[model samples]
Target chain A: DAGVTQSPTHLIKTRGQQVTLRCSPKSGHDTVSWYQQALGQGPQFIFQYYEEEERQRGNFPDRFSGHQFPNYSSELNVNALLLGDSALYLCASSFASQPGNEKLFFGSGTQLSVL
Target chain B: AQTVTQSQPEMSVQEAETVTLSCTYDTSESDYYLFWYKQPPSRQMILVIRQEAYKQQNATENRFSVNFQKAAKSFSLKISDSQLGDAAMYFCAYKGRYGNKLVFGAGTILRVKS
Candidate 1:
């Protein structure tokens, strides 16, 4: 079975520009979550999507948004990117939205560089 | 909000030796889960081990085990017979029983010397 997969292994964008990163959830998984890992820091939750709707979101601002397609794939969009946005964007997929069953399978993250 | 903390930013151990990475968390919820994830140089986050709050017995996976102290809110990972391949950034993560959201610690960089 395939694990989670993310596109655009690396990217570079200037401040105020936008970027969209894609993710394909693991097979048999229906929930997708996005995380941002800055240099020297742990991954921080961005948001989660289930059944094509956002189920939970972290402390991130409105500039960060995401969508889940019917097939359980996801896309994370960061608008008006700041230099601070430069980080590794990770995508994790789980079988369900429940807590105990939410063992996440993460993809090799997309490295975003904002100038 | 629940918070996880890893006191040690870096740790080192000789090959074939044992090393323990420490973690502590704060949460008002009675039920939750703790996880240890390893991110290698390739940057893929892999789950090392996990423990449910209700389970008193420590969770073990092969050479990796966790010392879960419910009262102290501590979860430490012990890697035995470490190898050079064990070197990676280990992160401690927590999630409450009600939601799937995870709060992670700053991460501990482990170096296994050959």
Candidate 2:
């Protein structure tokens, strides 16, 4: 079975510009979550999407937003990007029924560079 | 609020030897979950192991095992017979019973020397 897949392996954008990264959830998974990993640091949760709505969100600012399609694919959008926004954006997928018991399958991640 | 902490920023071990990564968390919830995720150079976050708060028995996966101390709020990962493939950044993560988001530690970099 296919695991999680993310598009735009790498991209560069300037400050104040917006970028959208895409993710295809793993086979048989319904929930999708996005995370931002700074250089040499662990990933910080951005938000989670279930049933086409955001179920939970982290401490990120409003500039960060996400969307989940009916097929369980997701897209993370960052507006007015800043230098700090340059990081690896990872996408993880899991089943909602299992909740905390289910292991998250992650994609290789899209590397975003903000100038 | 839930927080995870990894004390060791970096650790090294000889091949075939064992290495332990330390982690501690703070959470008021009686039921929660803990996880150890390994990110190699490829940048894919792989789940190494997981532990449920209510389970008294420790969680183990192949060569990876966790020492879970719920009272002390400590969770440590022990890798046995370490190999070069095990070299990566290991992150400790926590999630409360009612929430779906995961709080992660700063991570500990492990290097296996042959």
Candidate 3:
């Protein structure tokens, strides 16, 4: 059983540039949620995708967007990035229709550094 | 809005000893879930333990146990017989009954001294 997987272990982008991160949900899971973890800080929720639609979003600005494919994989896109965007982008997968006891499975995360 | 807070920025414990990490969350929903995730140097967010608000009994997993105080919105994690592998950043997270997103705390770093 493969767990959640994310692409681009690390990335570097300049201010005003855009970056895209990818995630493959864990097997048997259909919901994918994105998070940002600043240095030395816990991860903050970005958004969650279910049934190819965003079901919940955090306080993030409109510059951040996401997409969930029919296969349950997801992508996080950040546009007009700033230095504050330098953080670890994490992807977690869970079964949205399951009971609340079903825990989330997270990927190793992509380390993004904005110049 | 749900939020989590970890008061201890850093904590240390001798190997084979025990260590406790404190966490408190704010939420209005009576049905929800609380979790403690460990992020090691590898950067993988690993689920350590979890508690359901409906269950009054605290949750425990192997050497990891949680003191879940739903009335007080407190969820403290206790690691028994700590080992070097237990050294990592511990995070407290919460999710509402209808939401899939997790709100996390600032995290507490744990160092195991051999």
Candidate 4:
């Protein structure tokens, strides 16, 4: 089975520019979540999408937003990016039906570099 | 709000030896899940082992085991007979009973010396 896949393994943009990272969740999974991993740091939750609607969000600013298509693919958009936005964006997917035992499968992540 | 912390920034162990990575979390919820994820240089977060808060017995997967102390809100990963492939950044994550969002620690880099 194909695992969670993210596009544009690496991206570079200047400050104030906008960036959109894409993610295709693992087969048989419906829920998609986004995370940010700064250098030498662990992944931090950004937001989660279930049933095509945002279910939960972290403490991120409004510049960070995401969408989940009917096919279970997701896109993370960052507007007015700052240099601090330069980090690895990880996409994780799980089954929404499984509440307590939900296991997340992560993608290789898109490395965004803001200049 | 929930938070996870990994006190150790880095740890080293000789080949075939064992090492333990420490983690502590704070959560008001009575039920939650703890996970240890391994991220290699390739950068994919892979689940190493997981422990549910309600389970008193420590969760073990092959050579990977977790010491889950519910009262202390501490969860530590112990890797036995470590291998070269085990050299990676290990992260401790938390998920409450109602949500899927994970709270992660700063991560601990494990180095295996041959």
Candidate 1 residue pairs in clash (backbone atoms < 3 Å):
none
DockQ of each: 0.79, 0.78, 0.80, 0.88
Comparing to the true complex, what docking class would candidate 3 get? medium
Instruction: Please give, for residues A1-115, the per-residue lDDT of candidate 3 as tens digits.
Output: 8989999999999999999999999999999999999998889989999899998888999999999998999999999999999999999999877756667899999999998
Cα-based lDDT at residue A78, candidate 4: 100
Predicted candidate 1 versus true structure: per-residue lDDT over B1-114, tens digit per residue: 889999999999999999999999999999888999999999999999999999999999999999999999999999999999999999999998778688999999999998
lDDT of 4 by residue, A4-81 (tens): 999999999999999999999999999999999999888888999999999999989999999999998999999999
Candidate order, DockQ descending: 4, 3, 1, 2
Candidate 2 residues B59-93, lDDT tens each? 99999999999999999999999999999999999
What local distance difference test score does each model get? 0.95, 0.95, 0.93, 0.95
Give the worst 10-residue stretch by lDDT in candidate 1 chain A.
Answer: A94-103
Model 4 ranges with Cα > 4 A deviation: none
Residue-by-residue lDDT tens digits, candidate 3, B1-114:
787989999999999999999999898899999999999999999999988899999999999999998889999999999999999999998987766678899999999999
Of candidates 3 and 1, the better by lDDT: 1
Which ten contiguous residues of candidate 1 chain B have the minimum total lDDT?
A: B95-104
Residue-level lDDT tens digits of model 1 in A1-115: 8999999999999999999999999999999999999999999999999999999999999999999999999999999999999999999999884556488999999999998
